[model samples]
Target: MIYIYLYRLPPNSLPRMNKVILVTGANSGIGLALCERLLCQDRQIQLCLACRNMQRAEAARSALLVSHSDAQISILRLDVGSTQSVLKAAREVKQRYNRLDYLYLNAGIMPNPQVDFKALFKGLFSRNVIHMFATAEGLLTQQDRVNPDGLQEVFATNLFGHFLLVRELEPLLCQPGHTAQLIWTSSSNARRSAFSLDDIQHHKGVEPYSSSKYASDLLSLALNRHYNSQGVFSSVICPGLVMTNLTYGILPSFFWTLIMPVMWLIRVFTNTFTLTPYNGAEALSWLFLQKPESLDPLAKYHSLTSGFGNNYTQPRKMDMDEDMSEALYKQLLELESNVRKKIEEEEQDTRAHGQYLNQTE
Candidate 1:
């Protein structure tokens, strides 16, 4: 359910400028890498690191201070899985920062990941797999969790929560005379097999993580179409294969070490397998330096590394169904409306209780 309020721009103000960039999931991994790179290059730029864990957020801020002591970094606790948390965090950010220049919606999760080495080994010799798994290009696995929203954990955490956050922060995003960019981190693993419009949440036994990523890809495209003219520019980026904490969770720590040689070998053939966090953040870092109007609204930008380990952007056409995306958007809007009404009802009940207490006193 994507709720968008359109704002008509005056003919005089066509170019909107932004000075602050907010990134979610900035406590570690590629998010942290983007924060460091952005802060190092621009002294005046305000970088807000939005994370779920306060301790990790503080540590990330401390680490950023090492390179740029005077970096304008703010930590906002945002658990995208929870609607209440997202709204509260948005309100707090709104109070603190009047206008947002860029929003890097990079916070995502692939929980309870399990690798099928057997499938990988089979794929090595077999030519049957038309769509390759992200890790080995044959098969992948995942562990399931029930989300706070009573949806599949991966779908809720990875897509729905972010969807809600964007809806909640719509006011701050469409600030006049400011071109706000919503950059989403998508993946090459977003295959057609992963997503089913019939069972979008992946509750009917499927690779929920990949399904969620595919949904996000569609959602971002839908957002761009609906809101590009309203001072909101949406873009999605596939950061390629990066060895990060999320990937580490899929396999044992020793597995990453043992497969280092194989990974390096693969890097020779396709340099997009960025072995380091520094390499992974290159595309996201590049976007921060780009003008909003200069960016393509419909194309998903891919972050790939060259043979020399240099970063570059490659435009890829996504297999997106416009009808499915619009359907998802409508469903989300209904969910949002119901959720908002529930919140309003709860608030009214609390207020009524308070008045009753005052009268009794």
Candidate 2:
């Protein structure tokens, strides 16, 4: 069911110099589609796929190679939900690349998703049916749990882990004489009411997915405020209502198939139904071709598709205040400090126990 169009260039083509880009969760869905589109745009850039599953990463790389055989593509093992993995991946990236041009923080999760069918059915007949389908507002919820890092799984995977990676890679991202782009794959479901400064992790909420996405939007603005002067610019984009693995989890595959015609009908009313991954990546690819200085920090660029299959990117103002964004940034810094100290203590204890066992033997 998947098709990859082969693109070939002149045999004497040389790779571009110093254009290293890293994309997390690059093995599938929008991440993989973005990779394909990027290579199709410029096959010479150095691209690294940071994925949790190496086997899948390899498969993705092979698929990309079918079209871009001579392109510079590499794989990296990364599990952004885990603090230790984020730290390790950052170190590996530092050792491998001197400067990073673009970082696509596209990895995210919505574990144990549940849809309120009553709400969905009622909304379908309401005036806000298009809006509900576009954003899934008030219709979806998720069951989140704590990861080994002692953080909410959705928060850790969607926002905090990427924050830590950015902090660790500041050296590469904020290099002199060059501007780096931090592009977050945020969502339209991100609502101001879902996120709270005190409960940033959404520990007590069923809609942790929404809260985490909203947090990412706020964090992007904060990053630009703090790091823009240092040659690092941050932006967020929404891929619209794409049918990725995450979407499949919401309903059965057979159910989605049955509703395919209805979805297409809805697309005529709402451009947010970018059902395919390629269409979903329109905004992401559009951003790649844009100047970092020209983007608005307060706007979220969205991928929109017309009923006639036309694709475009649109930037809409987000409902957030600068003061709250700054406050959230400060709290994240404090959390990072506490996490680091805890990790150090755990390591020391582990080493001591190992030494004791060796001595006893």
- Which residue segments of model 2 deviate by more than 4 Å? 1-16
Cα error, candidate 1, residue 99 (Å): 0.9
Highest-scoring model, lDDT: 2
Model 1: CA > 4 A from native? 1-18, 124-137, 346-361
Cα lDDT of model 1 by residue, 6-29, tens digit: 999898888743378889999999
- Could you tally the backbone clashes for each prediction? 3, 0
**lDDT, candidate 2, at 199:** 99
Cα displacement (Å) at residue 149, model 1: 2.7
Tens digits of lDDT, candidate 2, 140-214: 999999999899999999999999999999999998898999999999899988999989999888899999999
lDDT of each: 0.80, 0.94
Give the Å error, residue 23, model 1. 0.5
Clashing pairs in 1: 1-332, 1-333, 133-137
Give per-residue lDDT, candidate 2, residue 66.
Answer: 94
